[model samples]
Target chain A: MKRNPIGVLLALIAALALLASACGSDDGADSADEVDSGDTAESTSAESSASAGPLRVGIVAPSASNDLAFTQSIVDAVNAVAGDRELDIAVTDGTFIVEDAAAAIRGYAADGVDLVIAHGSQYGGPLQEIAPDFPDTAFAWGTAVDTFGLPNVAAYTVRADQGGYVNGTLAAQLSESGVLGVVGPIEVGDAKLYVDGFVAGAKAQDPNVTVNVNYIESFSDVALASEAATAHIQNGADVLTGTAQMVVGATGVAGPAGALWFGTQSNQTPLGPDFVVASQVYHWEVVLSEMMAEIDAGTFGGEVYTLTLENGGLVIEFNDGAGADSSVIDGAQATIDGIIDGSITTSDG
Target chain B: MWSDFFTTSVIVATLASAVRFATPFLLAALGEAVGQRSGVLNLGVEGVMLCGAFTAYYVRLNPSGWGWAGGMATAILAALAVGLCMGLLYAWMTLVMHAEQGISGIGIFLFGLGATDLLFQKQVGVPLPISGLRPIRIPLLGDIPHVGDILFNHNVLVYLAYVLVPVITLMVNRTTFGLNIRAVGETPEAADTLGVNVNLIRLGAILIGNALAALAGAALVMNTNIFQQNLTAGQGFIAVALVYFGAWRPGGVMAGALLFGLVSSTVLQLKTLGIVSGAASALTAMAPALLTIVVLVIVSRRIGQPSALTRPFDRNA
Candidate 1:
């Protein structure tokens, strides 16, 4: 049969279109190559100096590396530790879906990265399964403490409640309305811990103060967070705080309303420089450095690292832009000292 | 706990939030209703929304010293243009190439999601705040006690949504274009025989629908005053579902959106007031989606979907 030239041309064009669409879908991973290239540059420098290359670190996070929340906290820690060093770092971000995260984690392990960080609580179960497969690869997962009793798996979690307590104490002192609002993400993992501590700290400061907490049941729904913040303000909450990436929405509301806002996960001063009084900055490096040291010492896993105020893992970073009074700063410092010295317990009332 | 929830302040707050939250959904769903009514089902609304959101956010961030109002206008227009372009692509794939509507839409969605996130990482790097649209109170109506706070005080986009509902309803029910759309949706062959340009009408409907969906994205970012990855957060899908729940009518879609928005706001209010404990908050958070499903099931039998919905047209065939 004679094939029509026009028909063949159309077929070729259609095939190309199909291929283009398929390539477009894969473009998400291509964006990550920029991060990978940075790692390559560092590893190349390290390889020239030593028979063994730099300590390779791979991270799989649920949100963007710059989300200014849970994921960014660790990403910042990794970058800080990698600064002026030969440590290699690679990250696959926006892996909110568990299956996608699992694939990335497994890929990293297959590539023989020295340490793989599974950076979400949702990843605990998958790490439990994958860690055993890569027994030689050091695996660190958190906001959780389950190591699956595996020798190569290490778990790290933030004592976010400690910083939450400090924030709550300062909020209570600064709040003229004597009403504080907290917009939490899902009531699980570190988010719930932070809210519980904030409420406790507020009550500790003023028993008569009304502290309202709202869990939006989503870690990434900024719109819901904004609505929650607005609702809190309407109900006479002069001070607001929240955890996770979505808190940007809440902080946006609070900043414009001239309400005080406390933040967590990472420094939220960038979100609302004028309103953000202080943030419970998660210096994961405080724990990460220790974990890496332990890994270097042949303690590959079976240990859980906890970030605490006493250990300086969770730092209360005051936003200098917010114009917090000296007395307020002094009071916050006193509370931090109290928590560290075991004098003021952060237990939920 | 329940007493806290029943307070007038809580009710007023929830109602006000409901109106604000419903704006995006109503706009997007109404747009989708128009497209579905014209026989094309574009599941790429979510992707289109993401694109619109990023475009609006980028415009808002740079502003080029356009000032607040000018920047906001520029952002909305930019978002609309992106949405219209996306609509054209979807129309070409489904109308000309006869690609599977669902798969093509999924492709568009993935492209939107990836492309937006990539651009955000490269351009913005960090989520930044913008001077978003602020609320405007309607003169005497805004002073009418509870009703004023609930209905008459909202951002300009919310008011636009309120106005679009009636305008869209009229356009769909009482105009020549409306008649042609309905005819093409029901029977493209008959409409074609009657001298209606079936493909052109369908293409126009797709463009209009997607453009509005993109505007919905803009409304969302403007209302929130900030943008982040996946900022729409499945609101686009909910908007699509809302069309079915609304029985593909503007008024019905608005009702569906209001119901969802109110339920969601109330759930957060209840959680805030401690009427719903943390252990049960997850379940309460599901209330809006659950209610949507239950309502959809109840109304499934009464409302008929467009016959040509999701099916591509071929003149020769």
Candidate 2:
């Protein structure tokens, strides 16, 4: 009976090992991809400063970083900055619950991690609430609007509209129906601007073309996005675009169903090879690398930094760069170059 | 007012909302059915559901790019394993150690919630954007006029929930294992004396029940196409109340679920129509739980649960 108990314990441990093995593939793939990013990794190390004891930092997000289209860019930027430094960078999943975010922030703060990059806008409120208690710690949230002015805090934002305008032009030119769809995230001020730019750009390309818009009221709900996309599909909209964090759900529906899609934030072409015509890509690596350089130089301070088209903060990723077809890239780049050179205007004004 | 409320969009929205609301409840209620039938009242359904949803989302999105099927299969499998382990642990605590079932179940719920959130923090490192399960419209039935469009045009889990209702009903009525489960709940000592292994049966039921609860979590995340922290909210507890309204029968549980789904859909549609104020809309969202409470109070006279629920059985007795 005692031997049986030992056997049962071993079986339980074995089962758990099998379960962990099953779970590791996704994470392991991330590491493998990092290895493939050899040049980028080397560049990161070369950039690290010797003066700073490779600042140990932790980042928390409200969701997992798998949507290569938007969230992955931010993650890549952070990881690049960390890998270059001799820093112990810890990243905890925020999972988007208020309580969980609070707990994770407090845990990291307790561990004396020099900086906690609360990346999601949702994390701003929680970090603000927790920040006062942990006075020694510094926080750098992603969105500008959420960061309250404090000695220990900084916020960074990008002019997403700059890229949105260029992609909107591509959507207009490529659409067979001359009707484009813009799926915004919850009607927030920033999302509204992105949608507004897309609409203005589409109409700028062809005054006769109509742009229909919908907002899902949250950044991460892909199912609702799909539902909204379905309605637009039913309404004869041929080119779909969204400002939400997860465009895959909308693009996933639009791609197989024969409607072309323009994506936002990160590169999303892999989600639907044929359907994802192009995306307004946000490269987090450059921004993080720039920021970390300042931080290592001992000149970093609490302030808001907003990047725009002029600084190469945002770029229109033609399907070509994403291993997409040549015909698509050439046509899209015509609009993209026009926007860059000041020949095309995507604004309503 | 009428145009906004009765438009084709509103009708489609309402049907979509019903499917969205029905999925988690159906999954949790099915789990509760198994737990209750084994004389163990597991109230930890909510915790198990949350953990499953979080873990499932993480499994789906890790970049080695497990395709859609692989992603979904991982979630289901992860949920099942977690459910099984939690169930076994709960059984050992409540059944073997003879702890209070209600308290132990609540502990399990709390543990599941915190543990899952922590594990997610360590593993996922950011919020995961798992693709929601796509709706697979059935062949001819999916093309059928009005009903087919409304009912069949939903993700796979919603259909699975619908099928489980009758399947479970039939299982409870027809199968020998089901008979033993029912017998164990009613009078464990008598069943034990009659040569049934009450411990084994109860443990089996708990594991099965937890699995169903995990399924509820998976269904919500997969069908909704996203996993939010505290995603299940109070759906698990509502599922427990539904068991009473359902009189512990699968048919009754499904009817109760349908009513809850309908009420939720109506409220959401009302919000979209702008008929309800923002404050009122918030209140309207609570309609399902309030209705569940009202149903329990009204239906208590007609329904009686097993006499020995929550009491651990001893063969020596």
TM-score of each: 0.94, 0.72
lDDT of 2 by residue, A35-64 (tens): 325564465456676665557666676554
Candidate 1 regions with alpha-carbon error over 4 angstroms: A1-48, B65-70
Alpha-carbon shift of residue B216 in model 1 (angstroms): 0.3
Docking class of 1: medium
Model 2 chain B poorest 10 in a row by lDDT = B269-278
Q: What tens-digit string does per-residue lDDT give for candidate 1 at B1-317?
A: 68888888789989999999899999899899999999988788888898998899888987875666456788999999999999988887778877777767776776777678767877798887888888899999999999999999998989999899999888889998888889899999999999999999999899989999999999989988888878899998999899999999999999999999999999988888878975798899999999999999988888799999887788898
Compared with the true structure, what per-residue lDDT tens digits does model 2 show for residues B1-317?
65766767567657656665677787789879877987999988887887777767767766256565466677778877887888888788767766677867776676666666446544654443455577788889988776677888877778888898888887777988888889999998889889999888888889888888888888767754555445565778888988888899888888888788778667545544446643554576567678888889999988778877998887664
What is each predicted model's overall lDDT from 0 to 1? 0.86, 0.69
lDDT of 1 by residue, A205-229 (tens): 9998999999898888999999999
What are the per-model DockQ values? 0.50, 0.12
